[model samples]
Target chain A: GAGVSQSPRYKVAKRGQDVALRCDPISGHVSLFWYQQALGQGPEFLTYFQNEAQLDKSGLPSDRFFAERPEGSVSTLKIQRTQQEDSAVYLCASSLVATYNEQFFGPGTRLTVL
Target chain B: AQSVTQPDIHITVSEGASLELRCNYSYGATPYLFWYVQSPGQGLQLLLKYFSGDTLVQGIKGFEAEFKRSQSSFNLRKPSVHWSDAAEYFCAVIEYGNKLVFGAGTILRVKS
Candidate 1:
């Protein structure tokens, strides 16, 4: 079975540029999540989606960070007007259900804002 | 707010030696705990999880963790660690519905 996968394993963008990171969760996964991991730090929650609905975006650091998961499978994390502080690895995870289930993670997209 | 704490920044142990990594979490309710391992250029892998059981949970690749409610700790242990076991370990707690709160992580250095 294919695990969660993210596209553009690496990305380089200039400050103020817009970037979109894509994630394809396992088939039939009902829950999807996005996290940001800074250098030498643990992953921090960014957003979450249950099926096609956006459930939580509280962890998003700023308004520039946006996410969408329409049709309940592929999710995208878009950062508008990228900043140097946005340079980090963006991780995506998916689970069979919304509670108590182990989340399968993707290799993550490393975004370096120069 | 809920939080997790990994007290050790890094630990170096010889191969075949016993290893223990401490993790403590702060949450009001009964919590769901998880241990994840991340290698360089790799995604996080689930090591194990504790969700109301016998307190001792066994996981993949010769790993186990004991959850102590009284002490608010879930410490991971391995009797003998291999060189391949060297990686960053994160302790996380599921809170506010389904989001995970992760610790700072502890890096393990295995010396052969």
Candidate 2:
């Protein structure tokens, strides 16, 4: 099985445009996570999901950021009215038991908002 | 709150030389630590992790990390550096349920 997969490895969007990033976690994985990594910075937590339930989204910068994982397989992170500050590499990860276990990460989607 | 710190921004080393990347963490209780590496145009690969019991943990790509509870650090090390090892290394800690808090990252440049 694949570790984790994110579509459109690179994206360029105009300001105020709506965008969506997709993440497909490992099959049968119960935990899914999203993170944002600015250039030269580490990945910061964006959201977490367990079995299709979003447990935490406290790290989302603003109301324009939203994510959902229906049926707990694939997840979508949608940004409404994108801004320049939103430009970064969006990463996705998945784990088995989800108790600090080893998390497998995707290649990441590099989003550029102009 | 849990936090990870990678003091060095960039490190340069010669091939076949030993390498060490420092990592310091802050957490109230015992910390679950990890080291991940990202090569150019590649996904982040887990190098190693430390939960409990073992102080020294070995991982893929001939890398190892030590969990020093008293020092509040989980530093990654490799006995011999390889050209392919030149990449960005990240130290991370788990918080809440399954979220990871990562350090700013350290870029390693291997000299031939």
Give me the candidate number with maximum TM-score: 1
lDDT of 1 by residue, A1-114 (tens): 999999999999999999999999999999999999999999999999999999999999999999999899999999999999999999999999987788999999999999
User: What's the TM-score of each model vs. the native?
Assistant: 0.99, 0.98
User: Which candidate achieves the best DockQ against the true structure?
Assistant: 2
lDDT of 2 by residue, A25-83 (tens): 99999999999999889999999998899999999999999999998899999999999
lDDT for A35 (candidate 1): 95
lDDT accuracy of residue B70 in candidate 2: 88
Docking class of 1: high
Where model 1 places Cα greater than 4 Å from the true spot, the runs are none
| CAPRI verdict (incorrect, acceptable, medium, high) for model 2 | high
lDDT of 1: 0.96
In TM-score terms, candidate 2 sits at 0.98
